[model samples]
Target: MKFLYIFTRSAYGNSIAREALDMALASAAFDQEVSLVFAQEAIYQLVMQQNSANTEKKPHLGVINALPLYDIDDIYYLAEDSSTYNLPPAALVPQAKALSAEQFSSLMSSADRIQSF
Candidate 1:
């Protein structure tokens, strides 16, 4: 089966991003093709410089950064969302592709199932 997981939350403020990451890893473990899409607030998770030192929350960058080791390489971030949040695509984690709205829409259409958070 194929799974497209869409996450739209920030890494530090909520559990949604972590949950989606875990689900993606689990899907990959089952040998299912998994695709990850980061939209809206979720785009913040891929930014290279996140310092959570002042906050009481921990960041999920470690988890996201490790996806490639588990064969979950088809990760994408919404280009428009990134632009809306003022995030430059060049500064994101190297493991993901930044897709335009049109490209992301095409990806969603190709998925067997889409789980959004």
Candidate 2:
């Protein structure tokens, strides 16, 4: 089945982002197609060069990088959110794609299952 994981929260200050990544990895491991959508504050998760050492929280870049290894490369972020946050394409991880709000909605609708974090 095709699974779409929507992340609407930041990776820091909570475990939801990690949980969503885990779910995506697991789904991919099971030979299922997995796509990730980052919207709202979740867009922060894709920002490169994050430093979490001071907070003692594990940096999420490692997990984000591992997505490709697990064959879960369909990563997308809302263009509206990126623009609002002044995030240029170069500021995001290499694999992140910016999609218009309409395209994002179309993707969600095309998924067989949707899970939000």
- Predictions in order: lDDT: 0.86, 0.91
Q: Per-prediction count of colliding residue pairs? A: 0, 0
Worst 10 residues of 1 by lDDT: 52-61
**Candidate 1 pairs with clashing backbones:** none
Q: Candidate 2 has which clashing residue pairs, if any? A: none
Q: Model 1: runs farther than 4 Å from truth?
A: none
True-vs-predicted CA distance for residue 83, candidate 2, Å: 0.9
Worst 10 residues of 2 by lDDT: 11-20
- Judging by lDDT against the true structure, name the best candidate: 2
lDDT of 1 by residue, 7-116 (tens): 98888787767777888899999999899998888888898888877776666678888888888889899878877898887789988898988888898899998999
Local accuracy of candidate 2 as per-residue lDDT tens digits, 49-70 = 7998987988889999888999
